[model samples]
Target: MDEVLIVVGPDVVADAGLIEEIAGREFAALGVRGSVTHARDAAHAAELLRDGAVVIPGRSGEMRELIGRAAGAVVWVDVERVDGVEPGEGATHLHGRGLGGIAWGIRHAAHRMRHPGRRRIPYGPHRDQWGDLYTPADSAPVVALIHGGYWRSIWAADLMEALCADLLARGLAVWNLEYRRPDLHGWEATTADVAAGLAALGDAGKVAVVGHSAGAQLAFQAAADGARVTLAVSLAGVLDLVEGDRRWLSSGAVAAALGRRVPRGAQASHGRSPHADDETVRLYIAASPLLRLPLGVRQLVVQGSADDLDLVDFGRRYTQAARQAGDEVTYLEMPGDHFDVITPATPIWQATAEAIAGALA
Candidate 1:
């Protein structure tokens, strides 16, 4: 019987049945009777690799070890990317990178749901126009937390509640900000919320903005739009909107956020004063933080080595631009996946905390 063994790390075991079906269909299309098999660990995977088995792509250390033992002949067979192979509920189909992002989103949501914030403050009349503030015993600089889910409506700022609590425990006042997702009020509403939150927080002590993914984009724009920010930390930020559109990052996330495809170097004027208390949506493609340079504020760009290659590249481009434009910018790269930058328990977050302290100091 003709068979092509499939090797995957521990995470894939839960969905082994779905993967088997996808693999079988793909192999059959290639004129072979493929039987799916899951290796228990890196050692088992190495044995399969030596026998010409196909290894599924994953960011797990075991998977990396197995790939290293393959002696450079490892074949990557991504059944998830196969056409007509739909990922299960709460799963992202089509690309392993997408899967990783979706998994993190789900985990964040679950974490947030389990742990509520200390207090909720409303910045606007809209239901989503509120911020959860986590206060320490003694007041400290306000660090605004923006969560990112490709700017989609399905994600909310609550996903960062865990991080907010951690920051508060560490002696920092946190405003876990939530703005309407682009699908609801468009990108303008998202930026408007950022502006409103910053304005409402007022100029009290050091105001540092820490945003993840899409939130990073808004934080930078808010700072440029006059947020009185002393420091801004973009964790896995989408710095270059034009480049993101070209690469189709997060599957057309930029286009969705902007409501259209914007060409590079297109100028735009959007949004209102961050101190304004009114509700108005204004979106401009030219407002991309990558183009708004020399922000005159200390900045930190944290890029994960295991994140999407496109994001890593975006961080590099942004760092270069900031440096050339004479902005005080520190680009730090850590070992982890795209979501690790937001996970407060990881060493990456330790590095992030240090960067925050350095920027404020």
Candidate 2:
């Protein structure tokens, strides 16, 4: 039996009743004997903290302290939009998302409890420079999942939860990576983190790297930089940075990621200009997968027909470019959306899983 503590803050926006209902449902679905307690304040939360207890702390001034007190895994939730806030050490952070965020936190905690073999390992000192590692009983191929959120700080590695669980079930070691986003840590840091994380997996058999959207760019970049990958999978990825910047895709997300536009009131620690410069162009060339052709590794480029038309174009063109560069490439374009490719139950994901297994075999 596992026990969970849901600590409510005085100013949280999430509905208490709904949160409780979702927590109960998640515990039941996992078939775990679980007891849940809703702690009313910081004092109550402190009292409930115990070894092996999963804690969910709602938005509050003392939320950080509460998370620090928890002896087991912690899932911290904040409904308000926040940027540049890191998750507590060994805790999963969900910010700017609504009640669904709370639900996800509860579900993640329950899932971790249900599968005790999974572990969180940190490769760097920064809070985001960590990964969730899941291993089967026997030796298996390795697959590293990098999530995408347009290189923004608000989004975290939770996006790849479904794929991580699915791959683990099929006897593959899964590394769900979390890295510093360009918006907060600088573009160079983001790239360096991915490379370092992959390098830490030394001697792992036949590693495959999978990235979605912005993550695709990182995966391709890592592969191009010689990250010991046997195969690279890009799911509805943003492959062309220069063209994406020209089209103002995602309202200039590319430029923002390249440090062309810093958020108001945030220091531009990377020393990038507000306008495009020669250095900016160089950055784009260095990061764009389309530009870094001849990755020299087997590549699976998967795109959904119903996703952003720009992404469809990028996938088609990038696949062609990679093939022309003499790299082994398999392009899979199907009917789905940007997210369907990552959802484990979707046909898109099933095809992706098959492709990955084949490539590793």
Candidate 3:
């Protein structure tokens, strides 16, 4: 009985087929069925409202009116617009545009960095719970680089080897941290591994924690949860897990990682959640740095304009929230993509080094 009614505007009717195809794949991935219906006018959209969940790509006069009237409807916006519906209107937003080609370019560049000497140290019994120590000549300032792949098993700390080498070249010791992923291990297990890994670093005084994507969440949590970290660098971090889930970033990777146990359903499809009793919800809230503010340390959020939309918003909102909560925070928005912060060849990486240097000072 559940169906998705995608309403396309008159201007974009020509490309309705392509849009529908993409929408279908996305919906099917989430185990939901969606049907595309091009509406000639606002009246036609209203007539199709009762069909099922309605999807309106971007802002439209008709869609806006429908949003005001049908509060119970599961509305989705393909791309967020300035005149979009209010947050309280119960709608889900999607980040349809991305720089996949640019990201690939940066990934190849990241893979080309000169290999540096690294000492592997075990943090826990599991092979995934280990740290790669890239040391300078003397007892230099330490920077912990945490890699991100939406807390999934596919991404590991190996991808950050080049970045670690770059930091070592800059006369800073780098700790490329690896922890269990939520997909492979349970969320609690993964979070516990991150905490344990930080604890295993021993008395590494006042080190800076640099996290990218999913790692950003862990980095923030490590700092707030009593890691020996002085400064926290969130490089295009997914700081807001709740918002990340609603926006369906990384093709519902957040939802996939969270699994179906929590049953986010339509409640979480909007920005906030109604179910606080769910174990997954509890764990997410406990781990979310955005919800638990005032980390009590200097923080730098490095964001890229050309990065994934979810990451961009996460950086902006997290920086503002930290500052508002009386924590010293700096936000650096540069012209780059998601992987630029980790690619040594990019200017974003240089900026990140500068931020770490300042944090060390």
Candidate 4:
């Protein structure tokens, strides 16, 4: 029987259904039967590779190991950039570098069900960095938590803790903060909540804000707006604003929030950005970290090649701009997708924990 075998690493639940469907269709199109099986690890894949099996594109240590181990025996495929997809496809149907696409759906739902919307929480500050204090003045550093979404009415501050739950073990307090969205108020309302929370904390140096996705951009904007931040981080922030603002303006939520259609054109869109409190023509340049620096804060930005949103090339482009402006910025790129840096039990999480620890220490 003419057939093709599909090999995949056991760790990739996100790609399972797509891989199977693709294999079956390809098999039929080629007049052959296609079967998919999990390799358990690279060792089994090594055997398949030895038999001239074609390697499916996915990135895991085992997949990479098998490819390097059998470069000649197998044909490597970038199944992600699948041969054909039509123009004007919705963003959800496409694949992003790391976990951008999958993470988006999972996160969008998670954020909506979890975060809700803008609300204020009490907090406190420590020594060194200048921020408000909520808890009694002591040596304990505040743990700043951030959430991710497209930054619209569809999501709020939910699920920020799951991927970043471990900062507590390192002697820091965590802050699960929120920002404005299409359903909420404007950017001013969101940042104002942040500003109020930080002020409540008391010591800016004792606080660290760890933010994800759209939350990252909000964090930087918050720090820049005189919030007295000690340390800040952005996890797959749509900081560049080029793509994000476009996407936001495209969404129905933006109109609902603004009470009008999102005016197109770069100048018009920038003017209507949720980053502001009102539809004022001013502060467009001052608001974006990419356009201007939110000075006096130490920052870290981590991205991955597999996740398109955090790709070093763009997405979070504001970090570099912030760095050039002489703000202390550290950039980290790793394997996996957008949420990869924040996912459970990885060096990314460990390193992030340590950075926050040191910043407060």
Candidate 5:
């Protein structure tokens, strides 16, 4: 039987016992052996990296060195912050998820062991420009999933893992994408990466782009800009950048994402406010899905009734605009939160999956 190791950093304040308990449960369920150890320091952590799958909890620059040495998969769990140290290649990272992140990492490691066909395919040279590809034995329609953390680097392709698994189970190819974020990279790079990611799936049949939150905007922009997308699905997406910026959604996440710099004494005007700079306005117009109507592709806009009111508003308005612009759109607004649309077990996602299947048909 395969054995997995859970290494807890000495400085980490989380409950190691609880993590072990969780890891044990997960390993047993996956038919893998598991053990937990507390590392005294960086050297100790490195020493423990010689064997089966490894799950390291806590952020440590030293752990990055051990990534190449691990014989099996490496999963890093950062319980504290989103901007924690990156483990680079040969490692999967789960950040800002607290203790649960450890469990998730373990599960991910186990999944990698169980499913050898799952592959990480790179679309660009940069470390972030890649997608996790999951496919069935037969050829199927591709579903490219774009995750969202308001265009921040913290959230990544891992956000869509559950949905990827769900879609693959339903006999669809899954591409959980990761791209450069505007916060670390420039907004242009972010857009370019999205386009490139979609283009990488050229040979994959009947591509459907499903993006959540900020990713929804990217997905829509890709479709509008003439990516090879047959259907575009937006889940609680920030479709309208101008209004999202004006509303100061997520404490001004939209402006920050667009790299907006509002000059002093600049006044709000015509859906372009707070930052009326010409370049900023141009960016908003180009990036926003609401502004880019008649995307010329079938669209499925799913909004949660209990999500951020701004998002709900954007979804509804965008659907209306798309329909008026002569675009085929299917709008689904139901009782759910921002995340329910992505959770495979939820009714909203069931409805969404059905809609996507029908559209792809």
Candidate 6:
């Protein structure tokens, strides 16, 4: 008989039910009948995994110790912490490329990235801009990418071409997305472009999405499309709307794009914003994969340690919710910032490709 072990963090009151359910039900759903142990003590978990494969929702220091002792006992899922990189609130200066220039480069690179998605199939005169044929043909599996500028428009898609190329080599189609700035298009309109781009792709085979920073918010829509999406990868994904609402207000620059036209008299900053209309707030939460993750789709959240803008707990909360929602979730915690995962040549992309291929298979 095969076996699996699931370890949940000791939030005791909150995670108790989750631990029990995962230990019992999750593996059962995967068609494996085995003992599910929800152990608070990592030492005990290590002892148990010697019996069979293990599944852990979190890799705590204590759990790490136990796993290190008997790492072979577990088939641990990689969980990401929040990106520790503190992206500038506004346009930041680069040694050679200033903020606007960087933005311009991103827009241009997004334009040049268009190519055949696969070798055998012909990608069309697609409506979307960030089109690079991954398979040497067109429109195989559009990994439509959207960069995060905090809706600030400074961080464009220029820094991400490497990630796109890597996905293409892995035989996954790439769509490196660029959108109208908060200065020009506003958040709603920018997202509309995302919708349009996806629609333009015309329901290709299992569109798997990868979004970084603000794009992580957009990836939620791709995963939640409830379409034939295979998997959704969020690297330093911005999954919480409340956090975004506050950041938008504080940065002030995002008001141009994020539909954050501050109300004249509203003074509330915590819980929920007083100025945000029901629809707007709903939209923000809607874009959040954490709130909208579907049951069938697999989700991989890759976050960095000690990330500055997005908190680590935010990623933890997201994975926890997905587990509760009955979605297959894999989390990876690498040691890097928001840009680390997107560094095309980085091992992060390779790991991501492996995960994607596994999911697609």
lDDT of each: 0.68, 0.79, 0.69, 0.53, 0.81, 0.55
* Tens digits of lDDT, candidate 5, 1-361: 4667788776777766787788888777657788888988878887676434455645465654555453445777777665635564566767776676776677667666656688899999988999989989988999999999899776777777778878898889998899999988989999999999999998776999999999999999999899988899999999988778878999999889888843444343333455555666656667888777879999999999999999999999888888998999999999999989988888999999988877776
What's the best-to-worst order under TM-score?
5, 2, 3, 1, 6, 4
**Worst ten in a row by lDDT for model 6:** 87-96
TM-score of 3: 0.65
Candidate 3: 10-residue stretch with minimal lDDT: 99-108
Tell me the spans in candidate 2 whose CA falls farther than 4 Å from its real position: 1-7, 15-39, 48-59, 62-64, 82-90, 261-277
lDDT (tens digit, per residue) of candidate 2 on 1-361: 5665556665555567886787677666656555656677778777766543445565566755665542556676666665555454456667776666665666566666666777888999987898889998889999999999999877778888878888988889999999999888899999999999998898998999999999999999999888999999999999987677777899999988997632333221123424334565556657889877888999999999999999999999999888988999999999999989998878989999988987887
Which candidate ranks first by lDDT, i.e. highest? 5
lDDT string for model 3 (19-51, tens) is 655666645543455566777777776666542
TM-score of each: 0.65, 0.84, 0.65, 0.54, 0.85, 0.57
| Model 3: residues with Cα > 4 Å off, grouped in runs | 1-116, 260-278
Clashing residue pairs in all predictions, respectively, total: 0, 0, 0, 34, 0, 30
List all candidate RMSDs to the true structure: 14.0, 5.4, 17.5, 15.8, 3.6, 19.1
Please list all clashing residue pairs in model 5, or write none if there are none: none
Give the per-residue Cα lDDT of candidate 2 at 118.
78
The better-scoring model by lDDT among 1 and 5 is 5
Q: Between the candidate structures 3 and 4, which one is better when assessed by TM-score?
A: 3
Give the Å shift of residue 250 in candidate 3. 0.9
A best-first ranking of the candidates according to their lDDT comes to 5, 2, 3, 1, 6, 4
Q: What TM-score would candidate 6 get against the native?
A: 0.57
Error of 3 at 193 (Å): 1.2
Candidate 1 local lDDT, 1-361, one digit each (tens): 2244556665553476666655655555434444555667766666665333456645566565443342432344333433222222222222323333333322333333334446778889976788877777776888888888888765666457567767777788888888877776876677878888888887678989988998898889888887888898899999887677778998999888888775444432232334223222123334478777878899999999999999999899889988998999989898988778887777888889877866665
Model 4 C-alpha lDDT per residue in residues 1-361, reported as the tens digit of each score: 3234555565655567776665555555434544677777777776665232444435676565454452332334433533222212111112322333333323332222333332334342311112211232244777667566654533434345454335544545566664444344565555566666556656545677767766776677778777676787877665654434445533533234334443344452334455445443244444445654646788888776677642455544666567667888888766767767676566666676677678778
Q: Residue 245 of candidate 2: its Cα lDDT?
A: 78
